[model samples]
Target: MEIYALFGTSGTGKSSSALELAYRMNIDAIIDDGILIYEGRKIAGTSAKYEKTKIQAVKRAIFHYEEHASEVKRILDQIQPSRILILGTSKRMIERIVEALQLSSPAEYIPIESIKPKQEIEAAQYVRQTMGKHVIPIPRVEVEKDFLQRLIASAQQIFSSKKEMIGETTVVHPPFTGGRIQIHPQVLRKIVLATCNDFAEVGQVLKTVFTFDDLPRLYVTLSLKLPYGRDIPTLMQDIQLALHKETSFCLNIAPASIDIQIAGLELITTE
Candidate 1:
C-alpha cells in the first residue's frame, strides 16, 4: 500500500485538518492518534488522546505499545487500502509509526503550513496553550464512550462548494495534556448536585452521572417535589437550561448533553 504523511508541530491544526486532506487526496483510510479511521469512522485501535499523561499519550500515538501496534497492523492487513494517510508532529514520528505498524515508508509528505493559514494555526495554538483544547477528527458522540466527559468538546466545520456540500468535520478534546488544570470527577459531581438542589423544582438529586467525553455532559436523574399546578415540561426545560448555564458559569466549561430523568414528582400539600 502507498502511504502519505502529514507533518506539523503539536496543536498546529494537523488533526483538525486531517479529514479534509484525506478527502482531497482520495485516501481510503487514516492512521491518526493510534486509531485507524476509515470512511470517517474509527474502526480499530484506541486513541492516544484518551491517555491521562502526555508521555503515555505520545507512546500510544506512535504505536509504542505492542498490543496497540499489533491491533492496528491487524486491521491494516484486513482492509489493505490502496492509499493511506498518516498524521504526526514530525517526520521522525511518522517514520516511527510506519515502522511500528510495519508499513512502507511514506511516498509523499505534506506540511501543515501548506494547508492552514497563519492566523488559523495561531488560533489553534492559543486554545491549546490557554484553554488546553485539543481537536480530534471524530464526532463527539463516539469520543464520549472512551474519554472523560468533562474535558470533551465538540467542533464542526462545514465544507461546501457550488456543486455539493462536503459535510461537517467533527472535533473532540481529549484529556491528555500536561499543563492543563485537572478537575476531579467528585468536584464536578458536587457542582451538579449543588446546582440541582438550588433549583426550586428539584427535590433531591437521585444520581448524577458525569460523562467526561464530548463536552463534559451530565446524565442526571432527579426527584422533583413540584408545587401543585406547575407545568412539568416547562419545569424540566427550565432545569435543563439552568444546569447548563450554571455549569458553564461555575466551572468555565459547557456541557454538551444534560439528560434529566424525573424519578419522582410530588405535589405540594396546602394546609
Candidate 2:
C-alpha cells in the first residue's frame, strides 16, 4: 500500500485540512488520532480525544495499546486499500503510528505549511488554545455514536471547488485538554427546561434525565397545553426543533437522543 503523511505541530490545522488533502490526493483512507476513516466514515479504532489525560491521548494516537493497534491493523489488512494517508504532529509521530500499525513507512511527507497560510494556522492555534476544540474528520452522526456526546459540538461539511460534497468534519473539545471549561449537569437541565417553557404550547417540563455514557443523551417528559385549535404534531415538532437548537447552542455538545414525551395536554382558555 502507498502511504502518505501530513505533518505539522500540534494545533497547526493538520486535522482541519486532512480530509481536503486526502480528497485532492485521491487517497482511499485516513489514519488519524487513533481512528481509521474511509470515505468520511470511522471504520475502526477509538479516538485519542476520548482519553482523559494528554499523555494517554498521545499514547492512543500512536496506537500504544495492543488491542487498539490490532483492531486497526486487522481492518487495514482486510480492506487493503491502494493508498492511505496518515496525520501526525511530527515526522517521528507519523513513523510511530506506521510502526505500531505495522504499515510501511510513508513515501511522501506533506507539511501543513504548504496547505494552509500562516494566518490560518495561527487562527487555528488560537482556537485550539482558547476554545480547546479539536477536529475529527468524520460526520457528526458517526462521531456521536463513537465519542462522548458532551465532547462533540457540530458538523462541518466541506465542498470541493466544483461544489461537490467532499466530507463532513466534527469539532470536539476533549476532556484531556487542560483548563477546559465544564458544563454542569444541573445548568444544562435548566437550559433544557427553559427552552421547553419558551414554546407557547409547552405547559411544564415534568422531568429531565441526562445520560453521560459512551454517548450523552437527554430524555425529557413534559406537559403541553395547546390552543383549542392548534395541531399537536406541528406544535411537538416545533418544540423538538427549538429544544435541539437551544440545548446544542447552550452546551456546545450534541445529544445522542432528545426524547420529549408529552405526559399530558391541557386546554388554554380563551380570554
Candidate 3:
C-alpha cells in the first residue's frame, strides 16, 4: 500500500491536522498514536494515550508490543487498503511504525510546517505546553471507547458544514497530561475589542460576544469611520481576517465564524 506521512514535533498540531489532510488527499485509513482508523471506524489497535506514563506512551505509540503491531498488521492485510496516512513526530518515528507493521517506506513525507503556518503551529504548541490537551483525528465517541469518559475533553467534526466532509475529531487529555487552561469569555472579548481599536477606521466597539460551543464563534457590534477611498465590504473582510489572525496567534485558535456588525458609520475627517 502507498503510505503518506504527516509528521511534526510533539504539540505542533500534527494530530489536529490529520483528518483534514487525509480527507484532502483521499487517504483510506489513518494510523495515529498507535490507533488504526479506517473509514471513520477504529478497526484495531489501542491508543497510546491510554498509557499512564510518557515512556510507556512512547513505546505504545511506536507499537513496541508485538500484539499491538500484529493486530493492526493482520487487519491491514485482510482489508488491503490502497492508501494510508501515518501520523508521527518525525521521519524516524514514521520509519519505526512502518518497520513495526512490516510496511514499505512512505511514498510521501509531509511535514507539519508544510501544511500549517508558523503562527498557527506556535499557537498549537502553546496550547499543548500550557493546556496539555491533545487532538486525535478519530471521533470522540469511538476514541473514548478505549478511554475513560473523563479523558474526553471535546470534539469537533472535521472542516466545514459541507456534506461530503465525513470525519470527526476528538480532543483528549492523556493520562500523563495535567489540567486545562481555559480562556474566559471576558478575556476573549478584551482581545477582540483591542483588535478593533487598533484599526484606525473603527470608531467604537458597541458590544462583543465570543462563544465556544463546538468551535470558537465570535460576534462583534461596532461602528466604523469610513476612510477616504475604502469601501465597507473590503474593510469588513479586513476586520474579520485581523480578528481571525489575532485570535489564532494569541489563543491558538481561529473561530468557526466571525460576525462583525456595523452599527454606525461616520466619515473620517482630516483637519
lDDT (CA) per prediction:
0.79, 0.84, 0.84
Model with the higher TM-score, candidate 1 or 2: 2
RMSD of each: 12.7, 12.9, 5.7
User: How high a TM-score does candidate 2 get?
Assistant: 0.64
**Candidate 3 residue pairs in clash (backbone atoms < 3 Å):** none
* Residue-by-residue lDDT tens digits, candidate 2, 19-47: 88999899989999999998888999999
Show where candidate 2 strays beyond 4 Å: 144-148, 161-164, 180-271
Top-down TM-score ranking: 3, 2, 1
- In candidate 1, what are the lDDT values of residues 81-161, reduced to their tens digit? 989999999999999999999989899999999999765665566556545777667665556454546445456554546
lDDT of 3 by residue, 1-271 (tens): 8999999999988887887888888888999998998977788998887789989889999999999999999999999988999999999999999999999999999999999987677667767776777887776668655465645554567654566546777777787876667778788888988898888889999999976543457899998887566788988899999999999888866777899999998887676
Clashing pairs in 1: 148-212, 148-213, 149-211, 149-212, 149-213, 149-216, 150-212, 150-216, 152-215
Query: Could you tell me the TM-score of candidate 1?
Result: 0.62
Worst 10 residues of 3 by lDDT: 145-154
TM-score of each prediction: 0.62, 0.64, 0.66
> Considering summed lDDT, which 10 consecutive residues are worst modelled in model 2?
146-155
Backbone Cα, N, C clashes tallied per candidate: 9, 0, 0
Error of 1 at 56 (Å): 0.5
